[model samples]
Each structure stands twice: as C-alpha cells, then as structure tokens.
Target chain A: MKTVLIFEPLDFSAKVIATLTEHGFEVSLNKDNISIREALEKYSLIYMRLGVKIDAKLLDECNSIKCRFILIPATGIDHVDEQACYKHQIQIISFKNKKELLKDIRATAELTMALTLTLLRNIIPAIESTKSGIWNRDLFRGRDIFGKKVGIIGYGRLGSIVSNYFHTFGAIVQVYEKNAVELPSHFERASSINDIFLNNEIITLHVDYQESNIQLINSSNLMLATKQPVFINTSRGQLVNEADLLVALENKVIGGAAIDVVNEELGFNPKNPLVAYANHHSNLIITPHIGGCTIDSSHKTEEIITNELLDLIKNEV
Target chain B: MKTVLIFEPLDFSAKVIATLTEHGFEVSLNKDNISIREALEKYSLIYMRLGVKIDAKLLDECNSIKCRFILIPATGIDHVDEQACYKHQIQIISFKNKKELLKDIRATAELTMALTLTLLRNIIPAIESTKSGIWNRDLFRGRDIFGKKVGIIGYGRLGSIVSNYFHTFGAIVQVYEKNAVELPSHFERASSINDIFLNNEIITLHVDYQESNIQLINSSNLMLATKQPVFINTSRGQLVNEADLLVALENKVIGGAAIDVVNEELGFNPKNPLVAYANHHSNLIITPHIGGCTIDSSHKTEEIITNELLDLIKNEV
Candidate 1:
C-alpha cells in the first residue's frame, strides 16, 4: 500500500494519522525534518502548508518514490508547482469544499464588517486616544455603516455572507464574480468585474483560489472602479497585486483597503510595503490574515480532515 | 394671549420657526452672545444642548416665562438642572414618546451590531493589519456571532433591535429589564437580573436614564455573569460603575467590552480610563457615546425635533 505524509506544522487534528494508518497504509509525520525534497522518496501522498514550497526537484523525488497524489492542506496552492505535479502524474487536491467552510466563512465575513465599522468610526484610535485619559468624542465623530455602497468581489462563501451584513445595515450591496454565477435571491450581482468597480463605494474580495481568481484585483480593476472604493482581500494574498494595492492607496485610486492576506515572499512586518501604506493612510486598515482563523474554526477544520482521512482509510481504501 | 418668547441657539427649522412666528410666540436664536441670564428673560421656552445649563438663576429670570417648558435636544438630562427646574416650576418636557427616537434607536442598535461583530472577529485589527500588509492570517483569528449567547441589560427601543441581530446571527438572545417589562416576542426575557448575569456570553446595557438603573453593573453583577461576556453600554454614562468595570477587565471577569459611554466629568478623549484599559487588555473596545449617530439617525432626529417643536408652538399656543 502507498504511504502518506503530512509535513506542515499544525496544532490540531491528531486523528488524521490514525485514520490513514487504519487503512493498512504506512503513515509518518515529518515533524523533526520537514524538508520535503530530501524525504520525498518515502511517501506516495504528501500534504503541507504554504511556507513549505514543493518544486520540480521534490516532484522528481516523489516520482522516484512512485507517489500518486500531492495534497496541499490549504485553500490556496500558490506554494506548489502545479506543472511539476502534472509532469509527475501526481493528482492534486487543494482547498476544502465550500460547504465545509461555510461556518468559518460567515465568521470571516462578520469580522470584515466589524473591522469596517471600527475603521469608519475611528474606534481603535478613539480607544488609543482614551488610553491616555483624554476625552475626544468629537475627534471620533465616526460614520455609520448603514446606507453605504459595499462592493464585493468573488461572490463565494465569504463574500455572500458579508453582503448580508451590508444589506441588513441598509448598505447597497454589489458583488463582482468572474463566473457570473447566479447569486442568492437577496443579493444584487455585479454585471461584470468593471461593474463591481464602477458602482461600489466599498469593495471586498471573496473569490476562491483557482488560477483565474489569482491577482484578480490589479491596477486595471482599481482604475475601473468609480468613486475610490475601499478594498478588502480576506480570500488570499496572491489574489491582489500588493504593489498595485499600495500604489492605489498612495495615488488615491481607491479610498483605502482592509487586507487579511498578502504575498508571503514580501514577509509580514511593520516595514512591508502594504503596512507602510496602511500606516500613512489612516483610511486603510490591516489585519494579520485571520479570516480562516478563530479557535473553533481551527478545531473544526482538523476534525473534518481527520474524519475524511478516516473514511477513506476505513472504507474507500 | 401669552407672547411666548423662545431662545434657541441653533438655526430654527423653517416650518417650526414659522409656526411659532405665525402664532403668539416670539422666537429669538442666540447668534451673537451666549449669556444664559440675558436669554432667559427674553424667552418662555428654552431649547438647549449639553453646553447650556438651565439653572435657578435662569429659571428665576424666566419666572414670567409661563409653562417654563424646557425642550432638551438629546435624551439624557444629566446636563439639565432638575432641582432648579422643579424649584422654578419649569415643566421639563423631554420625550415622553419613544416614537420620537424610534428611528434613532433602530439606527444605533444596528450600529452596535456592526461594531460588536467587527471587534469580535478582529475585523478592525485585521483591516489595520491587512492595510499595513502584515498578512499575519494566523494572528487575526476571529469568532462568528452565531451560536453565542447575547444579553441585553435594558430592553428598551435599542435593546429590542440589538437582540434582533443576535437572533439573525443564530445566537441565543436573552434580556434583563429591572422593572420586569416584557420585550419583543423574539427576546427571551430573564426572570431576574441574576439570570442574565449568570448565563449570557455577551451583555449589552440599554436602560433609560434614571436613578433606578444607575450603577446597575457593579462588582456584584459582574461576578454573577459568565466569566467573559462581550460588554457594551450605549445608554447612560453612569450606568456601569467605572471602578467596577476597570476591575472586571483587570481580573478577567469578562471576556471583553465594547463601550459607547463612560462615567466621566471631563467628557470623552482618547486618553481616558477606558482607553487605558483597552490598551493594556486585548478585548476592551471603547467608542464615543455615539450609538445613535448614523446619517439616517441624524436626519430622523432632525425631523422628530422639528415636528415636536412646531406642534408645541402652533397647537399648544
């Protein structure tokens, strides 16, 4: 039987290894040595997170090991060499089913709403301001989220849930989806990508991690947007061209942005380009890409993966 | 016929002022000077904001000012000298009708939901983090409002609307009204204040401004509730005792707080006790007392006051 391996460091789901093992398949977790290329010959199936890059060299080793499947245990497959996988005849599966993540998606959508209101009302600044014992209510004469135009790109799970908030708040909800898929009965769909840019006062991205959706919000889309829209990217970092996003904020193409993902090659720090832009632009709000986070979501994600692995080992295998 | 003189500082509504002018009342707005004593003798009805002090001296000057009806623009009458008004036989006519601020209350309740969701999911922080390009997705994990327990301390107009958000989020909603007043059908009213404090995961205060509801959430109340409930106050400033609240955060008596009001003599500033507390504690959030501050709410408030003043001038006279 083929062996399976998980190299990604995670603080959850202990049952995955046990389930795969029950199927009479040899299984081992690369906790001590996570360098995939060096250890590729040992496993037929491999799963890992974004930071651990799997390139052509790893694919060659996997072929030597007669590997049949490469599972990237995340939503985005930016770190994996897809062409290499194809050449090696490795079947690839990335991202959980959308229905599986609906609860978490709703959480992420709700988080975006919270952040938007906090930013608009200057709640953080007000909190910071009051820490020093100064009363500045007038300074925090913040605007309400009600009746604002909110544009959502990638009308998938997260985008759809966010639209509900906008609608409830009396905001005009506009959605941008490349597929032109029929949306929920309640939502107002954006006719085209340009339409999302043209009509929305605030824009949020919720597209999944297919190749087409990657880098979807580039300079052209920013230019196409009508009144400078407030951009948000909780979907994935690769979906937005960070440099262009920064430029958009700097050059005033968009009003501001609230980001949850960015290019990992850029690194996460105070001096990062987007961070630099956010600091200067009071309008921009940044977060450490926590849309998929939340203790409950993490636990649930692990449970789902483990259960799936168990089912495959117990019956499908 | 009584020549009722009206001294209001801001611009009078065309319709409202017209009603007074067309009737027997003579209206004068203080555009040049802000002398309370001088303005008192010239006006029978005094319209004022937080800045104006309707005291004994002013009331004595307006002794001949029949009815001595003082119309306060906002709900809270902390600024109004009630003792002086009573001694001088001033009939304080605030809003006996909650209908006057129904629009505003609804707006505020929706706003509170927006802010609460934002804070709970680290949405604002995520925005700031993302804007800065940090993309620390792991750091910004947030919880959804769904399946949570939300408690409303005072189930008046604002509380009823807020409770509705919890219901929409699929959360269990409970309310505690000191007077045992029944709330909306959706709301599950607590038989006692202890029940709310005992079971609720998130507690919001919406009691009216009066002696009965003052300092309602003291050390004892905080002790009875869940160890950590998302706390919010959009009612009176003095309702939650500041010292007790500060201690609650310090001891982790509650999970977090989102404040719209505070007990302070100096007014709101960035460097207040609550602000100081928020900085030290990750879960504390403080917004200026602006629950009813949406564009929709402001416009509604304008209409309500306009209609009320106009009706009083024309119909009463």
Candidate 2:
C-alpha cells in the first residue's frame, strides 16, 4: 500500500483523505507540520501547497522519510527545494493545479481591474471626503475605463482573464509572452516585451517567477514603460524589482501600480520609501498576496483538493 | 415642417442640426444663439437634455411658431418646465427615450459593479496608499465578493446588467421590482422588496426618481437591510432619504454606502450629516455623478441623439 503525506492543509483536504483512506493508502495530514522535522516521518510521497517551506534545513532529515516521490500541488516552485530532491534521488511530480490556479488568477485579475477602476474614478478620495463630510467634486472627479490601453505580461490564465474583462469593458488590452500563447480573439498580442512597454497605459505582470523574469521590471525596464503604466503583479512579487518600483513611483516614471503580490511577504516596513509613498500618494495600490484567497474561490479550492487526493488514493483518476 | 430648439452643447449637436436642417427645415442652432426670446421667435419645437433649465422664464417667451412640441431627447423629465408647458399648452411628445435610458443604465450598472469590486478588494485605499508611495496592506486588507447575496432594486436595464456581472463573479444575486419583470434564466426574483432586504448582503438601487419612489428607502426600509448590506446607488439621489441613509450608515444599519447621487447635488455642505459623518469614517464612498460619463459612453450618447434626430428629420424611424 502506498502512503502520502500532505505537509499543509489544502482546500478540500477532507475529501482527498476520504478518497485516499478508502483506497487503502496510509495518509498522514500535516496542518501544523511546516518545518522539516515533521516532514522526515512522511511515507512514500508528499503533497503540499503554499505556506509550507521545503528548504535545506528540512532536507537534512530526508533520509528518514523512506519516501520515493515529492509533489508540488501548484505551479510556482518558490517553496520547493528542487536541488535537494534531485540529490536525494527522489522522483518529483507536479500538477498543473488548475483549480487553485484559476481561482487565484481570476481573483487577482478581478482585483486588478477593481483597483484600476477605483484609482481612475478617485474612489478613495471620494470616500475620504464623504467621511470628512466634504463634497469636493474637484477631489473626487474621475475618468472612465472605456478607451484606455492595457498591457499584460504573461498571457497565462490570470492575464488572459484580465484581458477578457478589459476587452469587454472596451479597453484595448495587449498581452505579451516569451512563448506563443493563443488569447481570446479580442486581445492583441505583443511580440516583444519592449512593445508592451511602449504602448500600454497599464502593464500587468502574470508570468511565472523565473530568475530571468525576476528583477525583470527593475529600473531599466520600468524606465522603458511609457509614462507610468499602472504596473500590476499577481504572480510573484520578485518579478518586479521593488526597489526600482519605488524609485519609478517616486519619480513618476509610471502613472501608478496595483500589486497583489509583494516582494516582502513577511511584513512591510513603513520606513521604506515605497511604503511611505503608498501612504501619501493616490496611485499605488498594494495588497498582501491574496488573489486566490476569496472565500468563494477558497471553498472551491477546498473541494478540488479533497477530490484530487481521494481519487489518487482510490485509483479513481 | 416642425422644429425643436435644443440647447447649447451636446455630443452630436452638429449631426442633429444636419439631420434636422438637410430635411428642408430652417435651422435654429443654439450654439450661435442663447437668447430664449430669439429661439421662441424662430423655432416651434425644442429638444431637451440636462444642464438647461426650462422654467417659467424660458417658457413665457414663445410667439412666432405656435408652441408646437417639447421633445425630450433624454429619459428624465426633471429638467423640463412642466407647469409652464402645461399653462402655455405646448404639446409634449416623447416616446420612452430608450437609448439614453439603456445606455446610461448600462454604464451605471458597470460602475456599480466596478465600485463593489473595488470596495471588496480594498482597491481605493490601496490605490491611494500606492500613489502616495506607501505599501500598507494592513490598513487595506479586504474581503472577497463571492458568497455574498446582492440585492438589486428596480431590475431594469441598469439593475439587470449589474446582476449579470455579479452572477458571473459567483455572487448570489436577488432582485426586487414593483413591476413583474422577466429576468434571464439564471436569476430568481425575490417575492418582495423585503426578501431582498432580508437576504442580501448588498443592496443596489436602480429605481428612478419619481414622486412615489422618493424617500422609498426611509428609516424602515433601510432597517430592512440585514447583515450589514453595502448600499450602492447610481440612480437619482432623491430615491434615498438623506437623513435615513446617514443614520443607517452611522448606526451600522447597513455596512457602508457608495453613492454617485446625493440629495445635495450642488455639493455637500458642513451642515449635512453625511458630510459630517463621512469626514470621520472610511466606509462611505461618494462620487460626483460620472458613472455614464465615460468617453466611449459620451460618444454613444452623442451618437444616439444625432442618429435619432436625423431619423426623425428624414422620417426614417
């Protein structure tokens, strides 16, 4: 009988356990086991999502696992220790994880659009004034999103989703990718990253956090972006050079930004220039990485995870 | 041939003039002439939109061409001088101005969705923080929109359009209307307005500002809303009671409000409780009426006016 240990609590984990348990596989759930010491006791395989760290400190105890396989339940490889797995001669398996991906991407894209719209409409200032009992139309007057151009990087799921919405709203949405990807008929694909830089009034990043992609939106790249395209990233924070983003925002190189993922997921320092700027300026929007965390999507995610684990254990899929 | 004297500046006034002029009717363009006396002396008909007052002063000066017709190109009749027209016996002719109603309704619906999304994702505060060059996710952490029941009042074009978008985003949408309306297959109409008030997490008003509907949302009505329902309105300001809305907002009868229409349209004053409350709280968001003022929509407004006038002149419709 095969055994699998999930290092983190996944959505729908109960169903996944049921699928596995009824199938005669020994399954150990690890909701509290974030560290490597707890991981060392795993069986033949492992499954995990965000928040679990698979780093060198924990890899030292890998010999005790007697596990043959390692699994990453999502696309990003940030938390997984690939080199450690290779050295341990463990087979690695990864799923596209569409349920999580779709939810996260959709949530992120939707939030981005919301941010852009609110920013354009001066919704915050208006809210602030209304609270203050002030009705300064001058402070809250806003533009609409009917004819603006939006540049989207990483024409994957989230980017594509945002594209569909913006296009529907009559925004000219352009997307870019290192590899060719088919977009919905309405979206315009830009061949070069530079083209997205030149033409878009708003630039959103949805690409994976490849090293090459990391710091990709640093000083020079942001400088290339014409007149402050509202920079957005829901994928990974490192894809943009936060330091450079700060300078650009400070200097008005980009018009504004709406970011869901932050480079420092640990905590934000108000002392930082960007952090300080976000305090006073009316254009920059920063959210902790919460794109896929909507209660609606989260409920769906829980269901998918449970079913996937159940099927795998039961040999149903 | 009958003629209508429309006021200064509309989107397609030129086209309207061309439509009416080329059809063998003498043209009395208002851009070149602002004198009501001159207009009354020349033209027999007048087209109306917003911004121009048609009070007793303007209606008193008609002589040359028997007060033939007052054609309102827009839906709302609030701008028309009804008493004056009635006294002078100027025949008012208007089919339901479907184009203006639908276009404005659609735009308003879109704005409501946009506002709702922004509020849920904390986009306004985030944007303001970002633009000021700060990153404060703590202050702006927000909830997702899924699982929330959205109550739509007056399910006409605006209400219906917004409901469709909300449904797509995975919200449970309910509607309340005085007239039995045929909704798309996916929607379920609440048996009564209280059904929406009791069940929904959000309340959006699309009711027009007629005498009967004024103050429809008074103290008791506002009290009917449950679970801190966020209130949104793009319809006329009079549909909601100012004092009742303020009390509801202050006492947490509803969660918060996002309004584009206010009882005080000229502006909010120090004496207004809404203004006073808004200055101290962050939940209320107020916008100057610009939901349908997007560039694209504005162009469409002009097109509608121009095309309709041309059709009438050419007797094409």
Candidate 3:
C-alpha cells in the first residue's frame, strides 16, 4: 500500500480521506504535528498547509529521503522550499495557475470588501461603543462607500471581483495593472501607480508577491496620496514597508488602513508598529491573514487538490 | 422676519445655514438643546432631526404657540406630534413619500451591507484577536457570503439596494415584500415571511416602521429559522421585540445578530438585554442607530430640505 502523511489534518474533510482509502492509499493523519524526520521515514507522500513551513534545514535533518511527493492545496508555494525539493527530486503539487479550478475561490475578494466596509463604516468602534452602553452616534460618524473614487492596484482575479463589488455600491473604480488590457466601460484604467494614489479616495493592493515588487507601497508613492485615501492590503505583507506605513498612519498622510497581512506575521513581535498603533487608534484595522480563511473555500480547495493527487498516484501505479 | 430654531444644529451644514440666510429667513441654532417651551415661544419655525421628540405634552407646555412650521429633513415623521400640529394648524413638512428627493439617499442601505459583511467575516473579533498579539486564523474561521442564501425582508428602496449588493457578492437573494411587484430575473420572490426565515442562511429586515407592524420579528417568526441564520436589523428598533431577540440569541435559535437600533434608544437603560448580552458575547453586535448617519447623506438631505423650506417661506412672504 502507498503511504501518505497529512500534516494539519484538522481542516481536511472526511470525503478526501475516504477517497484516498478507496484508491488503496493508506493515509496517516498528523494531528499533533509530529517531527518531519519521523514522517519522512514512514511515508512516501506528504500533505501540508501554510501553517507548517518546509525549509531546507528541516529537509536536511531527514537522513532517509522516503518522501517523493508534497501536496499543497493552495495557490502560493512560498511556505515550501521549492529549490530544495527540486534538488531532492521531490515533486510539489499545488493549485498554482489553475484558472478553472479557482474561478469560484472568492474568499479573499470577499474579505477585502469586508475590511473596506468595516473601516469606512467605523463598525468596530461603533459596536464597542454600543457594547459599553453608550449610544452616541456622532462619535462614530463614517463615510459612505457610495459615490467615492476607489483605486485598485492590480486588475487580477481578486482585484476585479472587489472593484466590481465597489462599482455595484455606486463607487467610481479606477484600476492599475502592469498588463495592458481592455476593461469594462465604467472602470477607468489609470496611467500610473501615482495616479491611483493621487486621485482616488480609497486605494487597495491586490498584486501578487514578487521579489521585484517588495515594499511596493513605500514613502515615495504614499506621498502622492493627496486625498488621504484609506489604504487596504490583502495581497502580501512584504509588498508594503511596515515602517513607512506606520509613519504614514501616524502623520495622517492616509485617511486610514485595514490590513489582512503584516511583515511580522509568523510570530508575536512586541515591537510591531502596526499592531501597536491599531491597539491605540481607530484609524487602523488588522486581521491575522484571514483573507482566505473561509470554510467553503477550504473545502473546495482541499477537494480539488486531493482529487488531483489521486490522479497522479494512479498514473504512477 | 421668519425665525427658525434648529433643535440639533450640530450636524447642520454651513451651506444650509447660508442658504436660509440668503432667503431672508433668520436661523438661530440651538446648540445647547434649549427648552422646547423657550424655542416655541420665540421662533415661528422649528427644524429638528430624530434626536428631539415632539409630543402632545410639549405642545401643551407652551402657553402660546408661536411656531407655525416644523421642517424635518427625513422620511419618518414618527418623532413629531402630528395630531397636535394638525390641531394648531402648524404644518409639518418632511421628505415623506418624496421619492425623487430620496433617490440618492443610500446611507442606510450601505450600513446594512457593512453590518452584514462585518458579521459574516467575524471582523470585529478577528481584529480584537489580532490586537491581542494572536495570529491564529483558524480561531476566527468565518462563512463566505459568496454562495450563501440571503433573504431580504421588505423590497423597499433600502431593501432592494441591500439585496442587490449581496447578489453582486455572489449571494443568492430572495425578497419578501407586502405589495405584489415585478422583480429582476435573478431575485426570487419569497412566498411569505416564513419562507424568508425558514429557507435562508442570512435574513435582513428593512420594512418601514408602522404601529400596525410593531414587533414584526417576534419569537413566533424567529422560531422558523431552521438554518440558525444571522439576523440583521437596520430598521426601527420598535419593529423587533428586544426581549424575544435576546432569548433567541441566548438559546442559539439564531446564528447571530447585528442590530443598529434598539427599543430603548433615548435614555441609558441598564436593563437593555441586547446591549447587556453584546457586552460579554460575540454573537451580537450593536450600533447606536447610525444607519442614516453619513456626511454625504446628511449634506444631500439638508440641501434638498433647506431649498424646499426657502421656497415655502418665499411664497408665504
């Protein structure tokens, strides 16, 4: 029997396990996060999520290279050591560039709108105030999304979905993308990045993470935001300069920000300026990278990845 | 000279004041919330919002009725003493049934969507958790609105707008209204109130508040919510029975609730069960009746009302 070890089996559906078992694969569940070395010695195939990082050092510790397949049920492969896996002749399977499979994966786009709505409506403070038995509506006066000028940084899948949502709410959406393409008649194509920052009332980032675009929203582009637009980042933490964002928020250079990712996201860093600032001020709202943390999205992604893995194993047999 | 006393002049814009001044109508702002008797004794016209209550007792308290007009820049006239105004021939001018003037007044609808997004995304607790230096995304796993069935009660202006927003977010929308009307091809017309509560995963209320329909969402109808749907109320507080909602929430009869209005809105009542429950539990979220509170909405309503008032006064002169 072909043996497979699933790290972080909490969210893995029973249907996937049953399907694997039916196909003559003995699946071992890793509930307590056992050592990778032990797992490598036991199973030839491994499945993991973003929470568990597969680095070079961890791979080096495993003397016996029994693991030949690493299945990741996600689009991004940053959590896995791709170069190390390539050298070890281990194939990594993921949902990267699977357009048809990802057409309905809209949790991230939904969360982007959620963050924008919460910040624009002052929902957090307003609810807190009501919880404290105070009924002062004046203190939590917020701007309406209707008739506002919104700029989307990337015209990708999530970006287009979010911009369409804003457009449905009567907002004027302007999109900036590297790839030149025709857009809907209502949405304007911005000339440059500065045009998005300078002209719009709210700006959101949706570009993919790349080494060349690290710290994409630094002081230079942020300074051109004359409208004091509310900044939103649901893309990647590395895309923004944390120190520059902190300063921009403190000086009121931007209206406000609602972020789903941060630079110091792996561990609790006491000196994280954004988290510290969010604690004291209402101008900033942060979530712990939950842009795609919906149960429906998880189930769909898991089902697709597990079926694809089954297909690969069947071919090998 | 016609003298007008604005009871709650805090939100009264300078443009409205200047326009009133331009029309030769003397505007006196009552910033301190002066006595109703004093205001009635001096001014020939009174302008107020929802904060101030005009009742029969207040009308009787004034020995002589000098105020001839009560101008309200809103659709609801429940705050004013209509019977007393009629007896004294004091005309109560409001935007009631003025569809043209209210075409773009969409603050309440925007707030409805905001509250829905916040509750569905678990954004309030997620932000609080992140602020406490926790990065566990699994702890705050929320349902996506993309494929959820959302039932909207009352297909009025605000209700239709909110339903459209949810539909745009990829939600299945079902609407229930009193009058038989033609709907769009995508929207499903719910057979009855029970159809809305029984079949949907998320239900929202947007019915107009009337004496005949007080306590509309009582325990009887709430019991039919088999899906434990998230209940949203952005309409009048009196439309829902607060005591019953508290019971439903405590027993988990409903998934959760996000309410912007409450029964006891005027005074700080310690016994408000919803507010008390919201303080300790995450299932309920409350806001201080801020549905119609937005700078843009306020400006538009004020401008339209002020212009109409000027026309009336000019014709009288």
Quick one: best lDDT, which candidate? 3
Runs of candidate 2 exceeding 4 Å displacement:
A1-105, A136-139, A218-229, A242-254, A267-271, A276-280, A299-317, B1-82, B85-107, B124-141, B219-221, B246-253, B279-281, B299-317
Per DockQ, the best of the predicted structures is: 3
C-alpha lDDT of residue A16 in model 2? 57
Better of 1 and 2 by DockQ: 1
Ranking by DockQ: 3, 1, 2
- Each model's C-alpha lDDT? 0.67, 0.67, 0.86
Please provide, for model 3 over A1-317, each residue's C-alpha lDDT reduced to its tens digit, 9 standing for 90 to 100.
78989877767778888888887889989976787777766788888777767778888887778888888877767878889987777889998677467878888998888888889889999998888878888877788888999999998788888989999989999999988777899999999888999999999998887787899999888878898899999988999998998888888888899999987666658568888999999989999888888888888888888888877867987
Model 1 agreement with the true structure over A1-317: per-residue lDDT tens digits: 76777665455445656656765767777778756764566677776655567778767654375566676545656677888878878766655563554454355666676666666666666665666666545465555556678888776666767787677666778777776578777678777777888887778887877677777878888887667777767777788888888877777878767766666643456667776766665776667656656655555555555555455545754
| Predicted candidate 2 versus true structure: per-residue lDDT over B1-317, tens digit per residue | 76656644444346556656766666554788566556555677766544455677776655543655566544556756777778877655442446334443245666787777765665655555555545444455455565578888888767777787777666788888889778877777888767777888888888776889988887877888778888888888888888988988888988888777777664446567666665566577666665665544544555565555556646744
What DockQ results do all the predictions give, each relative to the true complex?
0.42, 0.25, 0.76
Lowest summed lDDT window (length 10), candidate 1 chain B: B2-11
Give me the runs in candidate 1 sitting further than 4 Å from their true place.
Answer: A1-51, A57-74, A82-105, A176-186, A218-229, A241-253, A263-272, B1-73, B82-96, B104-107, B123-135, B178-187, B265-275
- The TM-score-based order of candidates, best leading, equals 3, 1, 2
TM-score of chain B of each: 0.80, 0.81, 0.95
* Model 3 residue A6 distance off true place after TM-score fit, in angstroms: 3.2
**Clashing residue pairs found in predicted model 3:** none
